[model samples]
Target: MFVIDVIPFARFAPAGALSYRFNEYVLPGTIVSVPLRKKTVPGIVVACTSVRDAKESIKTAPFVLRSGAVTTTGILPKSYRIALTKTATYHLLPMGVILREMIPEAFLTHGFPKKLFAGTGHSLSFCEKTYTLRIEEYKKIISCTKGTVLIVVPTAVEIDRFADTFPSAIVVTGALTQKKRLASLKKIKDADIIITTPKYSFIPIPHLAHIIIERESANSYLTVARSPIDTRIAINALAHERSMQTTIGDYPLRMEIRPKPGSALKSISASPIKIFDVRKKITQAPFKALPEQILSIIKSTHEQHGRSAIFAVRRGYASTVICRDCGTSVRTTDGRPLSLITVAGKRVFRSSNGDTVIDAKALCDKCGSWNLIPIGVGVERIAEAVRNNFPNAPLVLFDTNTIRTPRDARSASTKFDIPGTIIVGTEALIPWLNPSNPISLAVVASADSLLALPFWRTRERLARLAFSLTERAEKVAVVTRRPDDAIFTTLENRLDNAFFKEEDSMRKQLNYPPYGHIVTIRIESSITKIEKDTALVQSMLKPKTGIEIPDRYATQNKVVRTIVYKYIDIQKWSDEAQELSQKIYRLPPNITVRIDPESLW
Candidate 1:
C-alpha cells in the first residue's frame, strides 16, 4: 500500500492537499479517483510514500485515510505541472481550483488519454496591427510550421471565422454538442492545426509546436464570475514553461505586452478616419441621434449601392432618464444610472447590472416631477432614427436584444452583407463583420459615452475599438462631444506612434500596467458582518504602504468591500504575496482575490 497526497477537484474542497491510501504506487501528477465525503471525485496525485516509510506518521494519524484508485497511469508533463502551480500562486487560488478550471470536465470525468506529450521550441513574437494583416501572417506561419499548431481566439465568433478560413482545421467551442466536442478531441490528435477558444486551450495535442493567441487585448480573456484568472497570462506561462513558440496578436497591442523598445510596430490603419465635433449640433438639437454629415454619408452609400454601419456605445433607447424640472437623474437601488428600454412597445427602466427593473411611467424618486427626459444615445435610438429617415433602405438592428444566439448573429451578418443595407449596433457588431471586405461607410454615433466608462484602461480600449472600425471600413467618422481629446487628435492625424508614446507616459506616471501590478481583494457578506470582516482584513494587512482599504459599499443585496495592493518590483513583493495568499486561502468563502484585475469597478 502507498500513502498518496492528492489535490481534489471539488466545488467546496479544502485549501490544501488531502491524504489517502492506495493499493498501487501512483506517480505524482497522475489522475486518480478519490473518495471525498460520501461521493467520489477526481483529483491529481501530488505525492506518494510507501506504507513502510510512512509507518510512524500513519500510526499517529488523526483520522483514517480513504482509499483511492488510479484513473490514468499517465503523468501530466513536468512543464504543465509547473505552469499550473505558477498560475495558482499568481492568482492566489487553490491548486485544485486552478486544475479544475484548466482541464475539461469531460477529460476529468473520463480518464486522460495516453497520447499527450509533444515536441517544443521556444520563441515569442507579437503581431500588433490590423486583423487582416494578422490573418495573413498567421497563414504564413501555419504553412511553414511542421508540427501541430494551436490557435486560441477570445470568442466563439472568432472560432467560426477561423474555421471558415481553415476548413481542414479542427474546431472546438463551448457551443459544440457533447458528442461533437468529443469527436473534435479525437480529431485533434491528428490535426495539423486546431482553432479553439480559451476554454479548451489545454486539450492535449500530439507534436504541438506553436500556440497563437488572437485579439489578445480582448476583455473576454479575463473571467470575473468566481475568482479572476487571466487566460492570456496562463497560456503565456504554459508556453514559456514548455519552451514552445508563441505569438500574441492584437490591434494596437495592450501596454503590458507591447514589444520592447525599437521592435514595436507602428499603429497606422489602412483606411482614412474623420472626427466630427458634435457639441454644436447637440446644442442645436438636444435629441439628435445622427449628425448631418453622418446622414449624408449614409445616403450617399445607399445611392452608390454600398454597405454602411453605425456604432453606438449603449444598447437601449436612452442610457439614462433625468427629471427635467428637478434636474435629477433616475438611478437603481445600487446607485447605478438606469437606462430606458422599449420592451413590447412599453417604456421600461433597467440598470446595466440587471439588478433593478421599473416602469418608466413612474414619477421621479427625488422629486415628484412628471416631466422626465431620456438622455444620451443608444443603439435602439440610433436604429429608430435611421429607420425613420431611410425607410426604404434595408436596415438591421444588431445589439444584444436583437441577436441572442450564433444563428442570429450569422443571419444579421448575412443581411448586412447586402449592398445598400444599413446596420446599427453596439460593440458586439465589431467581430461579426468580415475584415476582408471593407464597408463603404462607418459612423461612431457616440464616442464620448465610451470614454466615460469607469475603468482605468478606457483610453486604450477606445483606441482599439476605433482602430478595429477603421480596419473594416473605407471611410470612418467618429462623432465626439470632446473633439480636443488626445485620442481623437491622434486618430485624425494618423499619429499611431505618438498615441502610444503619450499613453505609455501616462501609465508610467500613474504607475498603471506596464509600470506596476495591482491585486484586488473583495469581501462580500451581510451588512452586519461586513464591517467586522473588513476590519479583520485591515488588521491582517497591517498598514502596508501600497495597501488601500476603502469604506464598505452596498450592492444589490449584500455589502461589499475591496482591498487593493500595488507594487512595482516583483522580487521585493513575491514572498510577501505568497504568504498572504496562504492566509487568504484559509479565509471564508465570502472573500475573493483577483490578480491584475481588468476593471477596478
Candidate 2:
C-alpha cells in the first residue's frame, strides 16, 4: 500500500488534501478516481509515500483508489500550480474552489486529454522587470516579439479584430464551440503567434515566451461574472514563473510608467467633446425627464439626415416606481425597489432581482395607496422620447430588453448602419460602435446619473466611455446638472493625461485598488442570526489595516445580510492574506465571501 494526498472536487468540504491508499503509485499531478465517503470522486494527486510510512500514519480507515485508467492532466504547469495554491491561500479559499474556477466539471470527465499541446521546454530565468511604452512603441513590441506570443484582449470583438491584425496568429475564445475550441487548440500547437481573450489565455503553448495585455485598463479583463480572479495577476504569475516578457497597453495605462525617454504613450485622435449645463433646463422644465435642448438636438440631427446615438444609464422604461402621497418607493416582497416597465402595452413593475414582476395597478404595500409615480429615466424612456420627437426617423432601441440574443444584437447593428438613423441604448451600445464608422452626433442623456453612482470608479468609467464615444463620433455632447464636476474639465479640455493622474492620485490617497487590496464578505441568514453571524466574521479578521462594518439589511426571501470590507496593504498583505482568508472561509454555511468584488450591488 502507498500513502498519497488528493485534492477532492468539493469546494467547501475542507481546507487541505485527503489521505488515500493505493496499491501502486501515481505521479503527484495525475488525475485519479478515489472512493470518498461512500461515493466515487475525482481528485488531483498531490503527494505519494512508501507503504511503510502509510502504515505508520494510519489513524482513520483509508479509502482505496478506484480502479480506472489514470490520466496525468496538465490542468496546471508547475509554476501555475504554485500560483494557484498561492491564490487559494491569498483568497482564504480551499484549493478545490480555485481549481473549480480553473477547470470546468465537464473537462474533468473522460480520462483522455482533449488535444492539449505541450509548450516549449524553455526554462525562464528569475527576474523582476517592467517596461512602459507609447502607442507606437507598443505596436513595435507586438510586431517584433519573437517565439510564440499570447495577446490577451478584453472582449470577443477584439479577438476577431486582433486576429485580423495578426493574420499569422491563431484565435481562441470562450464563445467557440467544443469542436472549434479543440480546433483552435490544435492550430496553436506550433503557431508562432496566438491571439485570445482572457478566457483562453491559459492554454499551454510550448513556445509561448511573451504576453501582451491590450487595453489592460478595461474592466472586462477582470473576471467578475463568477470567481473574482484577476487575469492580470494570473498572467503576471505565469510570466514570472516561466521567465517571459510582458507588456500592458492602454490610453491611460494601469501600471505606473518609469521615467524614461519616449515612455509616455500618445493619445489617439478624438472629436471634440462638448459639455452642456442642464441646470437651467432642469429649472425651466422640472416635470420633463429630458431637456428641450437635447430634444432639439435630436430633431436637428434628424432634419440634417445624420446618424446619432443617445446613451442612457439604465435599461428599463422607468428607473423607479414610488408612492406619490407617502413618498415611499414601491418594492418587491424583498427590500429592493421595483422598476417600471411596459410589456404588451400594459404597465408593469419589475425588481432588479429579475423575477419579481408586479402589475402597475397594485397598491403601495406601506400606505395602501393606489396613486404612484414613475421617476428617473432609462433607455426605454429615451427611445420613446426620440420616437416622439422624430416620428419619421429610423429608430433602434438597442438595450438588453429589446435585443435579447447575438442575432438580435447583430440585426440592431445592421439597422444602425442606415444613415440618418437614431440609436438609443444603454452602455451596452459602446462595444457595438466601431470607430471606423463615425456617427454624426453622440449624446449622453444624463451624465449626472452616472456620476452619482455609489462606486469609487464612477468618474473613471464615465471618462473612459466619454473618450470612447468622442473618438468615434463627429461630436459628443454631455448633459449634466453639475457642469463644474472634475469630469467636465477633462471633457472640455480634452485632457486624458490630467484625468489619469488625478484618478491615480485619488486611488492612492483613498487606499483603493492598484494601491491597496479589499476583500468583501457577504453573510445572509434569518434576521435574528444575521447580526450574530456578521459579528462572528468581524471577530475572526485582524484589523491591521481597515474594516467596514455596514449594517445588516433585508433582501429577497426574507433574508437579512451585511457586508464586511477588509482592506490590506498591497505590498505587505500577500504574506498574511492567506491566513486571514482561511479563517474567514471556515465560517458558517450562511455566509459567502468575495475577494476584490467588482460591484458591491
Candidate 3:
C-alpha cells in the first residue's frame, strides 16, 4: 500500500489537501477517485509514497482508493499547475475551482485516449509584441514560428472564422460538444498551430511557443461565473511561466500593459463624432426616444439605400415602469423593477429574471396607484420608433430578447447586407458588424444613459464603445442632453490616447484597479445572518493596512456586498492578497470573497 496526498475536486470545500491510501503508486497531477464522507469523490494527486516506509509519517489516511486504475492519465504539467495555484490564490478561489476550469469534464471522467508527454524545459526568453497590421502580423507569425502557436480569442463564435483565416490551425472552444471536445483534444496533440477561445487555452501543448491574445479589452475575458478571473492575465502568467513570446492587441489599445522593446505600434486617426444636443428641445416638444437629428440621419441613409444601426443599453420594451406620483418603481416581489413589454400582441409586465409576469396596466405594487410610467426606452422602444419613422425600411431587433444563439446574431447582421435595413440591438451587435456589411450610420440612443451607470469604469467603457462604433461605421451620432461633456468631444476628435490618459489619471487619483486592488467580501443568507456576518467580517479588517471600505450595500435577495480597496505598493500585493484570502476563508461558510471582481456593484 502507498499513501498519497490529494486535493478533492469538489465545490464549496475548504482549500486543504487530504491524504489517501492506495495499493499502487500514482503520479502527481493524476486524477483518481477516493472515498470521502460516505461517498466517492475525484481528486488530483499531489504526492505519493509507499506505505511500508510512509505509514509512520501519515497516521490518518482517512480514505483508500477504490482501484489502482487512474481515471485520468494526463497530468497538468508542473508549470501549469503552479500557474493555477497562483491564479486561485490571487483570485481568492479554491485551487480545485481553478483546476475545474482548466480541465474539461471529459478529462476528469475518462482517461486520455492517448498518453501525452510533458516537457520540463523552458525557453528562458520573454518579450512583448504589439501589432496594428492584424492580418500581416498573423501571416508573420505563421511564417516565422516552427513550434506550436496558441491563439486565444474573446469568444467561441470567432473561433471558426479564425480557423478559416489560418486554414492549417485546428479550433477548440467551450462551445464544442463532448465528441467534438475529444476530437479537438486529439487534433491538438499533434498540431503545431491552434485557434481556440480562453476556455480551452490551458491544455498543455508539448511544443508550445507563442500565445496571442486578441481583443484584450473584451469584457468576456473577465469571467465572473464562480471566480472572477481576468483570462488575459492568466494567459500572460502562463506565457511567462513557459518563457514564451506573447502579443496582446486591441483596437484603441489598452494603455496599462507597457510596450516591450520589440513592439509593433500603430498611429490610428480618430473619426469625427457628431453630437445632437436635445436638452433644449425636450422641454418644447414631446419626449422622443431618438432625437430628430439622428432620425434624419437614419432617413437619409435609407434614402441612399444604406444600412444603419441603433445601439441601446437596455434590452426590454421598457427598462422599468415607475409611479409618477409616488416616484416609486413597480418592482417584483423580490424588489427588481418590472419591465414592460409586448408579447403576442398583449402587453405584459415581466421581471428581470423572467420568472414573474403580470398585467402591464397593473397598479403600482407599492402605492397601489394607477399613475405609472415607463422610465426609459429599451430595444423594443427603439425598434418601435424606427418602424414608425421609416415605415418602408426593413428592421430587425438583435438583443437578449431576439438573440437566442450566436448563429441568430450572425444571421441578423447578415440582414444588413441588404440596403435600407435598420438593426436595433444592444452591445451584442458590436461583434457581429464587419467590413463587408458595415452600417452606414451608427446611433447611440443616449450617451447620458451609459455615463450614468453605477460601474466605476463607465467613462472607459463609454470611450471604448464610442471608438468601436465610430471606427466600424462611416458615420456616428450620439443623442445626448450633455453635449458639452468632454467625452463627446474626445470621441468627436477620435483622441483615444487623450481619453485613456484622463481615465488613467482618474483611476490613479481614486486608487481603483490597475492602480490598486479591490477585494470584495460578500455574504448571502437570511437577513439577520447576513447582517451579523458582514459586521463580523468588517470588524476583522486591519486598520493599519489602509484598506478603504468604499461601498457596502445589500441586494434584494438579502445578500450583502462589501468592497475594500487596498492601495499598497506593488511589491507587497501578493502577500496582502494571500493574507486577506486566508482571513476571509476563516469566516463562516455563509461568506464568500473575491479579489479584483469584474463588477463592483
Each model's total of backbone clashes:
0, 3, 1
lDDT of 2 by residue, 436-554 (tens): 56798999887887877767777867876776786568888898889877668777776344565676677677667767766777676776676677678767774542244554345
lDDT per residue for candidate 1 within 1-601, as digits (tens), equals: 9898888877777756889888878767787777777777777887899999999999999988776444543567777778877777778787766776777655565455555554456789999778888988999889998888899998887788899888999997778987888888878777989998887787777678899999998777876457867878778778877678999898767878886521334655578779988666325444678978788888998999999999988898988899988998987666667899988988799877766788988778778887889988998899888988899999999998888988998878888788799999998888877787889998888888888876787777777788787778988889998987778877776644556677788877777777777877788888788878877776666666335455444575677677777767755555766777777777788987877775654
Q: Please tell me which predicted candidate would have the highest lDDT against the true structure.
A: 1
Number of the top-ranking candidate, with TM-score as the measure: 1
Reference-based TM-score of each model: 0.88, 0.83, 0.84
Give the TM-score ranking, best first: 1, 3, 2
Question: CA shift at 511, candidate 3, in angstroms?
Answer: 0.9
After TM-score superposition, the amount by which residue 5's alpha carbon in candidate 3 deviates from its true location, in angstroms, is 6.6
Error of 3 at 57 (Å): 16
Ranking by lDDT: 1, 3, 2
lDDT of 3 at 157: 53
What C-alpha lDDT values do all the predictions have?
A: 0.79, 0.68, 0.69
Question: What is candidate 2's local distance difference test score?
Answer: 0.68
Best of the two (1, 2) by TM-score: 1
lDDT tens digits, residues 1-601, model 3?
A: 7777777766544466777667777777777776666666777877788877876555554554444443444566666767776777677766655766666555555444343343244332221222225545767876787677888887755565577678888877767787887787777767878888776777657677778777677777877564467677677767767777776666555545534211222345434568788777335455678878788888888999988889988887778898988998898766666888877778799987787889888898888899888867789889989988988899989998889988787777668778888989888777677632347888889678778777776776776676677556888888888877666766666533455556667767776666677666666566657657656776767663323343333355565555455544656777876776666657776666666554664
RMSD of each: 3.8, 5.4, 4.9
